[model samples]
Target: MSIVIGDIAKECITVDPSTKCQNVYSMFEEKTALEGIVVVSEEKPIGLVMKTHFFQKLSTKYGFDLFMNRHIDLVMGDELLIVDYSIPITEVSSLAMNRKQENLYDLVIVTKQNHMYGAVSIRELIMKLSELQIRIARYSNPLSGLPGNNVIAETLQEVITYKRFSVFYIDIDSFKFFNDTFGFREGDEIIKETAVIISDTIQTTDNEPSFIGHIGGDDFIAVIPHYHYEELCKEIIFRFDRYIMRFYTEEEIERGYVQGINRQGILDNVPLVSISIAVVHNKQYPITSIEQLSREAAKIKKRCKNITKSTFLALTE
Candidate 1:
């Protein structure tokens, strides 16, 4: 099996060319894996900037004063190697290995047409090449490239065994209808966006370590400690609802949405891409069996699914 660029690409961090250097510096500090940042305009990639550029600017005389006033466009590298998403990993690897410092561009910017997709790091590419040779079961969803069901289960087991945490099962409501109406490509984009939103929300607001997993299709699971679970859920729901609602057409938005009826004939008029969440806390209570606990939590999720009244639910018992 050949390696692919998508296999090792890190998620892209984007900034506007007009954005202040201070903001870019702050983002880099927050995201350590950010090897490079893409400068985008109207969702299109225009230039690339690296961590070293910031350091170089900082080392100069009166660097702090300069950085405080400079914009990203003035220092960003305008000539970037743009690659299509389907490029082979071997090709990307060769490109990274053969390039010298004089021709050094460690990050490859990937996109489809004009839209900004993501970025890939040469170091990460090299590491992935090593990992690929080993017998590793990559827990990736072929469609979204997010971790799949097996990973979710393993993460749940680990969280339950070691730490006191709350696990949340997040489902996108009316996803099927959205797929049916807008076509699969758009549906895929929505899924990717939802994943990004969930990831960003967790990373920004929660200080506690979080274990997040993609459980196929429109379902996601997050395991966070009890203290932060409530706040995390609220933030997720708020962001998700705000973003998903934007994906709908103005006509559909105004027409009052209709969802498929359950076993009973009922008219549900919720937005096509709302989120439904179910949370279970791991307490000190005696558990006769793990399977039983899982079943109870699943039952709570089912009950939450039955009512059309709420988008989030937490299992108290």
Candidate 2:
């Protein structure tokens, strides 16, 4: 899923600094399609000479006579954009665009361990960047594959403005426990699994008007019917308990916890990961603002975490 500049660089004709400008001109004349020449010294790129810019300078008054016999270094454009072969193309694209306008179309020199590798044309860079983005969107999610916090806020507003909707705030209980004990990669899988359960459960809740979003890592929000929330919450908890257990081992489950360091840097037995859902609505209490809904959900979420298993608590009062 990772693509670097080297992956897209094409072979570029190279010259040494001491090479004559006349020699460079002949090379360009001989190769009609040659776009640029890289100047190298001690196996490292030091400058670049673009065909368009080179001819532009040569076409100036007395330009050819004043420079043709001189060393190519004297006439070659030193304003350069050089990037490491290992740098991601996404980052390199920004560097390429930010260069001085005169150097905008210059071939970007690619180096490996600081030695010359090849050159990437602006055309190749743009085409590869677009293609990589398409692949990433289709496969990588950019990796989370969920609508983000801004969408979550809009969902909240819609709930308050238009209709009576139950808010479900799903938090992974002691997610840090698994994240610390197992590492982020393993923890990420847990988050993805939890997302699936929430999405599937909400979608099946009598096909009521609903929306779900990831409020970033390990926290999710859903809006569903006020009437159907009880069934949906129980189903989410049931499915979570059944499916999430696969991420743990028999020994850890038997022991009922994993060892992890807490925020105070104290080592302790952190309980197994569980789901906590705080269900809130305007039915029992006046939902005046987003902040109030959050305040109520936070209180219910705290109480839900106190229980020993996957559980849900509704806002009361």
Candidate 3:
């Protein structure tokens, strides 16, 4: 049994159409997932207002004071895209995507008849689709969706618990030049493809369970049980280097391309996509904490980035 729209939807946040905008903003702040509030009157859904509308109104000539003076009805979206509890998750996802395309809201209110029932987020919809055996094209970078720093912390924690592992921090050398030359989207695709390759390489071996995490942008981390550290890093570097070459134009690959210097005075070039990797085997140092292990791995990663002109690998003693 697949998860359905009704199974995943959160209870809807509702407000009277006459509610003051100030109150709405306060409530919205309290409910982080409250993308939009459904306006109801006399037990019937009437309109919808979103936080973006509130922010836009805030930036007007009146600014924050407008919240005190205006009613939600004044800012509500009149034409709403809503789903019923009975709607199939697939149909709900389509409706949600259409709403996102037409408007920037992240959620849609689900209702029964005219009364509000619940709301669904795009994240929830995607998860539901995955559960239903549907494969949607994921736009997020395969290595690190947002490439936020939290992934690094999580990887370290995993190592702390497991005790005997190797941590490899990987970076692409001269990625900025490629981005500058081929356009950012192409650079993004290359990064995504690189992430996929790195992930696949690390997980392929039959050694202890390994983890691959994106540290955002061009940085990635792979955790392998101590037994497989050597083989995994070698495989990752080999596969990543091979795959990266395919992303460049033949001329650019052959002749290479130079990039303008930034304020940092580093000569930028569209060189062959190479990776600098720092590997640390936990059994040797036996890190007692996640933070210390992460700091050490990051330090080594930075060192690899600094000394190597192209691709380099360093292992912690």
Please tell me which predicted candidate would have the highest TM-score against the true structure. Answer: 2
Off by over 4 Å in 3: 1-152, 247-259, 262-271, 307-312
Candidate 3 lDDT by residue in tens digits, 1-317: 11346767787778888898888888888988667778888867778777777677788897887566789888887777676775657666766676645464556667777567788777778877885442222323343453334544654665676646677777887787667656888888877777777767775436435656676778777766664566666776777766776765677666655455644766655346677877766555567786676678677767776653444454543
Residue-wise lDDT of candidate 2 within 1-317, one digit each (tens)?
Answer: 13678989877899999999999999999999899999999998888899998898889999999889899888778878888876768778989999989899999999889889999999999999998667544433233666676556665766786356788999988887678777899888888888888888886426445666787778888887565688888989898888878877899898878777877899887788888899898786578788988999989988997886788888862
287, model 3: CA deviation in Å? 0.8
Q: Which ten residues in a row have the lowest lDDT in candidate 1?
A: 203-212
Query: Model 1: C-alpha RMSD to truth?
Result: 15.9
TM-score of each: 0.51, 0.53, 0.49
TM-score of 3: 0.49
Clash totals in order: 0, 0, 1
lDDT per model vs. reference? 0.70, 0.81, 0.67
**Per-residue alpha-carbon lDDT of model 1 for 236-299, expressed as tens digits?**
8788767766666778666657455533455555555677778777574633444755776788
Q: Please tell me which model should have the higher TM-score, number 2 or number 3.
A: 2
Q: Which scores higher on TM-score, 1 or 2?
A: 2
| Per-residue lDDT value at 71 in model 3 | 90
lDDT order, best first, reads: 2, 1, 3
lDDT of 1: 0.70
